[model samples]
Target: MNDADPLPDLDPLVPSTARVYDALLGGRDHFKPDREAADVFLSMVPHAREAALVNRDAFLRGVQYMVREAGIDQILDIGCGLLTKQRTHEVAQEIDPEVRVVYVDKDPMALTHGRALIDTGQTTTVVTGDLRDPSGILAHPQVRAGLDFERPIGLIVWMLMQVAEAEDPDGIVATLMAPLASGSHLFIVTWPDTGDPAQRALSQACLETLGNGWARPVDRVLKHFQGMPMVEPGLEFVPRWYPGDPGREVPSAEDLKPFERTQIAGIAVKP
Candidate 1:
């Protein structure tokens, strides 16, 4: 990967959601502003770091299931943050080297870092796009050329919480999924509001720091699936999804700490 300075026009003073997420994940691609934002978030939610780790682990598991069991050979990871250790392409390609992946993100830093790190060849590539513009992303030339729309595609919407309600998050999901062939899977990971006062406060803290962190209720989040059939163990806390998988051992949702229940995830298939 390129160890050079960030892009010339990129402002280091502004804390990007992607960078703050990277900082929360204990990654090295964040700036001082991002680290400060992450510190503020952690102060509000003491288990923020642990929640981030759980979210990443759940995402990796979802990717593995999509490739190994669901027979999905191509992926479109929307709002993909900075390049992490076990990224979508890495996990999917490990199972099958021919798997194709297209990473999309609005953060300039993420795009720059991804371009420098991941191979932009036939099997993998990164594109600059915003989640708010689903049509634009779907029409991206690289995205169009990288994968076949005629077959099943795995759509990973891991940063939906970063999109506020005013931005039409549900419509965004619908638009992104409408064109895909049947049998395509939709994997989502987002913070869920469980009506707890503490959770509301945490959501406020996130909004103040991230500018677009809107934690939706479980029902509203389920609407993003657009009536598709959810995979077994439907939308649940990150730690509880597919707990039977190797290396994933956790207590029941009722036994989980308040902070441990901050995030929720699930996979659904278009019928």
Candidate 2:
């Protein structure tokens, strides 16, 4: 991995979703705008930080299951945010050094940082693409070259909530998965709308500050899988999935905070 190149000129006043997420994760790469947005979000939803941590932890667990248990050697992580430690490639490659991973994100800064932090050798690469345009991402030269469609791929869609309802999130997922060979798997983490006023306020705050994203109802979010067979413990709260994974200490459902219950995750496989 090489040092990141000098970033392009960008407005510090503008809040970037990736940077805001970094702020939520307690990372140091965010700017004033990002921190301000995060503060505003936290003011309304005090558990936002804990929720972010839970989401990340669950995502990493999903990656471990996909690579170490499911025996998937290739991963396509769509809407991957800023590069962070214990990310997809790190977790996957740790299990098998030859694992191939392609990180996809529309944020220029995220792409740049990912490119810098990752090995960028034959085993890992970062591509610039939007999740809404699944076809564009699938057809990207780097994506096609970095992964083989004939092989089972572990597709991670951790930020599906970023796509608005008008954008046909379900269709986007179907298009992305259609070309992959059977036995491929999908890992998803998203906020599920429970009609709570606080949740609605949080969704509105995200849309206003980040320029896009809203929480979908749990049933609607589940439809994104398009009837694919789910892995064990289907569509549970993020912290509840695979709690038995080594070193993970999951709280009981009754003990979980409200925000923890708001986010749901699951892994499904194409038969």
Once fitted onto the true fold, the runs of candidate 2 whose alpha carbons sit more than 4 angstroms away are 1-9, 243-252
Residue 243 accuracy (lDDT) in model 1: 23
Q: Mind giving the per-residue lDDT tens digits that candidate 2 earns over 24-80?
A: 889998899999999988987888888888888888889999888899999999988
Off by over 4 Å in 1: 1-9, 243-250
lDDT of 1: 0.85
lDDT of 2 at 67: 85
lDDT of 1 at 111: 84
Structural RMSD, model 1: 3.4
Tens digit of lDDT per residue, candidate 1, span 1-271? 2233223257889998889989998899999999999998888888888878888888899999999999899999998889868889999999999999999887888888788789576799888777888998899878898889999999998678877777888899999999999999999988788875546656877788877677789998999899899987889888789822544566887898877788888899999
Q: List the residue pairs that clash in candidate 2.
A: none
